[model samples]
Target: MPTGTISKRSVDAANPESKDWLLWDDDLPGFGLKVTPAGGKVYVFQYRLARPGQAERTPARRYTIGKHGKLTPDQARKRAKDLAALVAQGIDPRQQEIDAIAAEDEAARVAAEQARLEGELAFENVAATWLDHYENEKGRRPSSVRQAKLVVNNHLKPRLQGKPMPHISRSDLQPVIDAIPAKQRGMRRSVFAYASILFGWAHKRGDIPDNPLASMVKPQAPKARDRVLDDAELVFVWQASAKLTDPFGPFFRLLILTGQRRSEVAAINWAELDRSTATWTIPADRAKNDVAHIVPLSKPVIAELDQLALAEQIKAEEEKPDGKRWPKSGFALTTTGRTPISGITKAKNALDAAISEAREKQPLPAWRIHDLRRTLATGFQRMGVRFEVTEAVLNHVSGAKSGVAGIYQRHDWHDEKRAALESWAAHIEAIVSKKQKDSKVVPIRAAL
Candidate 1:
């Protein structure tokens, strides 16, 4: 190796036939210019890097600056001096360049990861995952799952769908929570509870840093419902119900006669009925309490089931253009008979209209289908039916047989429940017909 001040003229004048020789600068020990056999001249720096915690020197590393013409001798000398200063301070310039390139690549990776997360963990995406878990994984009933999706899609998603997960705050949710009517306390509570659960789920999964609902207070607690239809209202409902068309009309009558949940009554399957024994078995999955309940069908309930069965038979006989005939779904209250009845809103609206027209009175008090269940229970209690027997008739699992007693006591009160339901059904018939004298027993098979 030769040592001298590296200039353009000196580099160009050097032997073209020389086999890749390096000329080091006399002013700067490690700074040099490499001249190849093809006469290409480039400024370069060579230095031996010291091993950590040792006096031993490793092999020298060569770093290219630029071509001879790109940087003059003065500019090359200045750049080389700066690099030499870095070497004196125990820093490897070559390693520093490699680390800088790696830093740029790491920064790009982080930016890309952030962009992906922004799209994937938005409020709508999290809500979709939550809904899948509720219906598919947790095995919730279809009706309940439908309601949950309604709240999320109609209310939650419209407001928060595109918002970033971390950017969501309690303020973002408070207005939505406040918008739900206080009179519908139970629904408000449920909607808020579902929203809180969604945020909590995202937080637990590391999708969001914190739950916005955690800091926000929940909607007001629901008041206990005690509304039961009086005799006048009961008569009004019964008469109006008869004027209703098939399926919806019969469905409402069953709601009153059976004293079961509206969903349970509306979604009843024909296969659940046993005509000879006059009994309808509600499966565990369909029951609100998740317990398989046996409902002893009275003559009225039996007659209603028979009416639905007869209609289905008639519909099945009706021929289509293809001559395939109408299909029969296992559900009792469906229009198409291929799926369960889904026009609850339309049915209720029609019932309300009929009731108002029949009464000609100052706007009837607002009531839901569930009020019929309460009405039946209250009526049974007034008729001197024992509390336990009435509870069993309603298939309620609480009261005397709740908690440890419920766990230990296995008696189902089958006989008592049957007698109570039969008695209640007979009483409802007498009221609907506006007949007096409890002594006169009303057969449940009478026309509605």
Candidate 2:
């Protein structure tokens, strides 16, 4: 061993021999530089655990400070002094370094696990997975899927977008249910149901440790809607619908004339309409009851559809200069011929504004597009149409057709359905024309 104050000059003058040699620092005991025959130079610190008032000496332990070029002699000395202080306090510096490395590794592992949980259990990510399973795996109807997505995006996602699934408690979601307006009781109930289903699914799949809303009381189901538009309101809505642009204008009128669901009517393809048969056939896949429905095209219904077709044709002709040609067949009512008209809510808002403007003194009550179907059903009842005929016309599987009767009575009621719908159309014409009340059923073709 060669002893000296470890300085830059002494370190530079030191040479490697046939064997490894150490130059111990004169200023700091146990701090030295080791030069290997392989031309490697390293700074090292040797220390023994302090045993206060003991006759025996603990075994010496050595700790590698760092490579010489990587750390100057002064920098290595500062670290060696730190180790010496720990050794004087009866701490083994080498064991302390080993323990520190172990703690750092444990901390890194825990952080990585936390990151993985965040990525996998985030509310948005889990909700997306659940929705995909709900729609594709569970085979839910398109309308039901759309409704679920609407509630999640519009109500839930805004509140819990990036939150971890397990960290979410009932407190985080209760406000979401409570925030829905009283007027939208159905929506409130739907939000609660959707949240419960999502959390329940996560818990079942082990994506979440526990369901946050497991103990929360579900919102009460909304009362069945019996809202039927009166004759005056019906007339007001019909007249206001005229103020809207293409697609929506005819879309609203067709919804009223045919008494079909909004989605069913909006998604009507030109192929679904048969002019020769004078019927719009809703395929089983599109129909809510999973049974095909034939809606008789009364003269008024045909008239509205014809006007839509002609308007689409005229617009296509106008677009000919722009290299656009009319599609041979597509959606019956669509702004673009490629797809059915969407943004129905936006269109309805515009229609309501028109209605409000038309009747400035008396505001029409809040009503949904679904209310139109109910209104038409009520109208059929008042027209003396048979219950079975009305059920067939509306394609409802309940009432006269449900259970034993539905199993037994397989009547298509084609002619009776036509007569009922025509009568309903005639009644609508009467209301719109202000010609007569619904008491006398006028022939729709004569009225047209």
- Assess each prediction's global lDDT (C-alpha) against the native: 0.80, 0.85
Per-residue C-alpha lDDT of model 2 across residues 1-448, encoded as one tens digit per residue = 7899999999999998999999999899999999999888999998776467885777877889999889998899999999899888888887888899999999999898688568887888999998999888443567888888988899999999888888889899999988998777889888888888889999999877888777888787889988899989999999999999987988899889888998899999878888778888998888887788999999888877777766776765654332122234688877777788899999999999999999994668989999999998888777667788778888899988998988999889888888878888878889899888665675333422
Clashing pairs in 2: none
Model 1, 1-448: lDDT tens digits are 7887777677767675558888888888888988888888889988887788889988988888888888988898888988888888889999899999999999999898677567786778778988898888554677778878988987788888788777788888887777777787877888788888788888998988889888888778888789999878888888888887888888888998889998898889877777777778998888888888999988888777777776766665743323122223388888876777878888888888998988775446999889999998888767776777777778888997688988998888777677777777778788787676555654322311
Over all chains combined, what TM-score does candidate 1 have?
Answer: 0.80
RMSD of each: 6.1, 6.6
Model 1 root mean square deviation, Cα atoms: 6.1
| Number of colliding residue pairs in each model | 0, 0
Worst 10 residues of 2 by lDDT: 319-328
Clash list (residue pairs), candidate 1: none
Total colliding residue pairs, candidate 1: 0
- lDDT measured at residue 130 in model 1 versus the true structure, 0 to 100: 85
Candidate closest to the true structure, highest lDDT: 2
